[model samples]
Target: MIKVETGLADFDIGSETQDVARHGGGAIASFVGLVRDDGNLQSLELEHYPAMTQKALYGIAEIAKADWALHAVTIIHRVGKLAVGENIVLVVTGSDHRKAAIEACSFIMDRLKTVAPFWKKEVRLDGTDQWVEERQSDIDASKQWDE
Candidate 1:
């Protein structure tokens, strides 16, 4: 199963993954990405298109399922005004082996960075906001999976 949500509350995918893996699989690999303080940013806000974001995430989840023996997958990306310490994203993938679970988790995150429609604005110390750009490295990383 694949789920995606955008809201103000935090997300927890590790517990869900563990529960699904208890009887259905071997390992549960999870990753949590948080907004950084960095002493240079005060506030951060994430923006994402409603229908399109969910569709892209589900597509990524399907790709993972096709490439691995995935038992379950969950992804949650929070939007709206957020503090420096808030959580940004959560991803969990389960499989029959550690290697597959770990690799799939990495694959999901890499794809999310490049292909996901989420946009972020970082508030600097001087109170200026800047839109985060998609880096060339991010594009290159996604292409590695294709080759």
Candidate 2:
């Protein structure tokens, strides 16, 4: 089972976890990214072309499924404006073994952060806004998988 989706609505983590678990995987691992409340932050606005975003997300999930021999993989990325502390994305990976499930979850998230075609802007409480830049830390994290 492989599920990839992008939209403005929030997702239910419980249902997602259950859906992956039902696929007969012995181990399941998941990650949920949330909008951080930096002192100046009011909200985060996310944008992406629908076709490109779906294709990219599906491609990443497929790679994880093949490389890790996963039984199931799920990725959900939310777009549009989101309030502080809202869920931004969810990644779940399930496999026969713990190591594969855990690592694949991390792998998918790393790729999503660096490769997914979503643009983000931060709106400050003071009414100022700025586009978010890719951080060196994120680039470095994604590079480790290439080694």
Worst 10 residues of 1 by lDDT: 14-23
Model 2 per-residue lDDT tens digits across residues 1-147: 999989988999999999999998699999999999888899999999887898899999999999999999999999999999999999999899999999999999999999989999999999999999999999999999999
- Which tens-of-lDDT digit does each residue in 4-104 have in candidate 1? 66677886655666665764788889888999988899888889888799899999999997798888888888989888888899888888899998999
Task: State the C-alpha lDDT per candidate.
Answer: 0.85, 0.95
Off by over 4 Å in 2: none
Stretches of candidate 1 above 4 Å error? Answer: none
Report clash pairs, candidate 2.
Answer: none
